[model samples]
Target: MALASIPTKQYIEQREEGYWIKGSRVSLDSVVYSFLEGETPEVIAQNFPLLSLEQVYGAITFYLANREFVNTYLQNGEAEFGQLQKDCQQRSPQLYQLLMAGQARLSQAS
Candidate 1:
């Protein structure tokens, strides 16, 4: 007898950007990161109350099943986020410079 194939339904959803859990805006990365940080599934669910424990387990299963691909996708996403932050800072240089100046002042006061 053949084992049943995995169905992504009720567990994961593919968006334009990437995979997110069904019925919640939480990304699979949040789950994976928390898991990597040694957080339990229950704690992950608490960290993202919108996700149930079962969903957390399911996401972990998916990640385990496709660890390499998922890791690459996570890396690419981090790179993209870094680029976006660079673009935003470039677009609003003055705001960030002023914010940096305030932070420097606070650090000196401490």
Candidate 2:
């Protein structure tokens, strides 16, 4: 008897904004970050209800398979986010301070 072969699905795709899970709007970075932060695949799936357990496993597998490329991409994204935050703070210091204060208040309340 021959074992049946199952075709693989493309779990990740690169869009103009960034890498996202195929067929969903969730970003691969979000899943990867949560995984790196020690969240189990089961927890990650629960956190992202849009993604199935299989998809979470597949995304993690993709990250492991292309670790180098994904790491570079994530680093670049972090740099970009940092630069953007700096620009925003510089562009409107008062507004930035206000937003920061509001965030602090929310954190304290939580």
lDDT of 2 by residue, 1-110 (tens): 99899887899998996999899989999999999999999999999999999999989999999999999999999999899889999999999899899999999999
Give one digit per residue, the lDDT tens place, for model 1 in 1-110: 99899864558888987999988899999999999999999999899989989999999989999999999999999999889868877999998788778999999999
Superposed model 2: Cα runs more than 4 Å off: 1-5
Judge candidate 1 at residue 28 and give its lDDT: 93
How far off is residue 108 in model 2, in Å?
3.3
Give the residue spans of candidate 1 off by over 4 A: 1-10, 98-110
Clashing residue pairs for model 2: none
Q: lDDT value for candidate 2?
A: 0.95
